[model samples]
Target: MTYCLALKMNEGMVFASDSRTNAGVDQISSFKKMRTYNNGTDRVIVTLTSGNLSITQSVVNLIEQRANDPDVPNVWNAKSLFDVATLFGECLREVRKETAAYLDQTKVDMGVNFIVGGQVAGEPQRLFLIYSEGNFIEATEETPFFQIGETKYGKPVLDRFMQPETTLVNAIKCALVSLDSTVRSNISVGLPIDLVSVKPNQFEFNSQYHITEDDAYFSHISTSWREGLTTLFDGLPAPDGFESNTQAAVTESAQPLGTPVAQTSTQHSQTLTPASVNASVAPVQPSSTQTEAESSSQDNQSSAPTTSLMHAAQNNQPAQRSPAVAANQQNTK
Candidate 1:
């Protein structure tokens, strides 16, 4: 498995991916998950892929072959980013068609995902997520980022930090932080990471870097993020009223209020205490109980000549009654 993230920002775009694949415990290996194609001044396209390394490689080979072909409409000839994406989808489909039969014979799964993003002359930068079936979707203003493979563990941070208007540097920083989170939580994704940044209207991409284990910027973010999280966790207040007698109190709190309180277990007696709030054993009949309480309080109000129902209604703690009851009382008055 792998993790790839691409972001389309106002100022530019950012793409990142991890480079790890494993067939089994004994067959773990690293391969670059990012591939970039540049036509000098006309366009620059980056493809980040995950799943089924064979299929991904075949797709990349097909794309390169098409680009090199004089007769084919390749990345260089594509009129817009949309056309480029369609070309990629076509390439993926062709690869699948060519390899599916052999891979099926070998019983190897033919799964692959590609995140293709770049700019072509005369159009804004665009990003596309091409699926195994050759269908694709582009990023939009509302949803400005796309992530492929092992995405869930790293999504929350992006959802919180990424925005269409975010600066390119900050967006790249956020992407690295996101990768840091995923790498810590999952083993399938690891360094070295491929990072690419593309600025708007610039036909070529800038700031492409390989982040290995010893990369200073990445190491600083990873270490500092972990330390910051640790400090934050340490700074959070402990559960309220749990400083002493916590286990006993929690256990007692779990029991029904009307149920007989049993002796605290010796193992937890020192830490356990009864909860201040009692639990309700029976279902609360909101209508009947509230009506009875209201009627008894009304009787008290009637007995006190000075305290009128009107005055009681004016008070902050007016008698608790349902809307139906209040309507009935008003009709009678």
Candidate 2:
């Protein structure tokens, strides 16, 4: 598994990818997931890759070999970013065709996902996400970013922070924050990250960084993010009575995100104090009888009131029988 992300902003584009590769816990290794091909004067292309490294490496080598040959269409001579994206897809298809059958026999997959972006002279900068099948979708204004490989852990920060109008350095910071989120949560993604930035029409990289565990800035990002989350959690107002009772509160129970915070609340969720519960219970409900028996006697009563009583009961409170309920029970008796 890997984590690679690209942000296409109005200022330009920002990209980040981790370097860890592994077949298993013992087979861990480091390899670059980013490839840059540029002439500096007329064209620039950067690609971040995930999935089978062999397939991607082969595809990249093929593109480079063809670019230098001059006898074939390449990034250097491509008419636009669209044309270059087509070339990238074609290269992936070629590599897949060559390796697919043999790998299939071994039940091994040949999937390789790519995020390719850059500019060609006289054309606007563009970004694309190329799948293992060589087809892709371009980044649009609505979603000016693309991510590939072990993407979920880092996506929340990007969804929260990134936008086309975001500044280049700010986008870079968000990318690092996203990477930190993934690197800490998943063992398959380790670091020594590669990051690149480009400004529109620049035709070359504007900033390139290789961040390792020891790098001060990256270390700060990782430390600060964890600390910030800790602080945020500590500062939140917990549900009433959650902190006071140690064993029987939320910490001791199995709960999901959708459940209400205060389990023992009724009366429209606001009146949940133990004293209120007792006061509400003692006055209206009589002992040694089912509330349902009394409710049945008041069949002519409107369902709206009975529904309200049941709703409160389901909220872990005593069901309050109204005056009509007591009169109904008397008539039934």
Q: Which candidate is the best by lDDT?
A: 2
Give lDDT tens digits, candidate 1, residues 205-278: 77988999999999999899889988888777555434543233354445543333332332232332224324
Q: Best-fitting candidate, measured by TM-score?
A: 2
**In candidate 2, what are the lDDT values of residues 1-333, reduced to their tens digit?**
899999999999998899999999999999999998887898889999999989989998998899887778998889888988899999999999998889999989687899989998898889999999999999998999999999999999999988889999899999999999999899999989999999988877999999988899999988898899988887776554355333324432233323243433543544445323322332223445677677776685655444466787778766666767778899998
Candidate 1 residue pairs in clash (backbone atoms < 3 Å): 245-271, 246-271, 248-272, 249-273
- Prediction 2 global C-alpha lDDT: 0.85
lDDT against the true structure, each candidate:
0.83, 0.85
Model 1 quality (TM-score): 0.73
**Which portions of model 2 show Cα errors greater than 4 Å?**
240-333
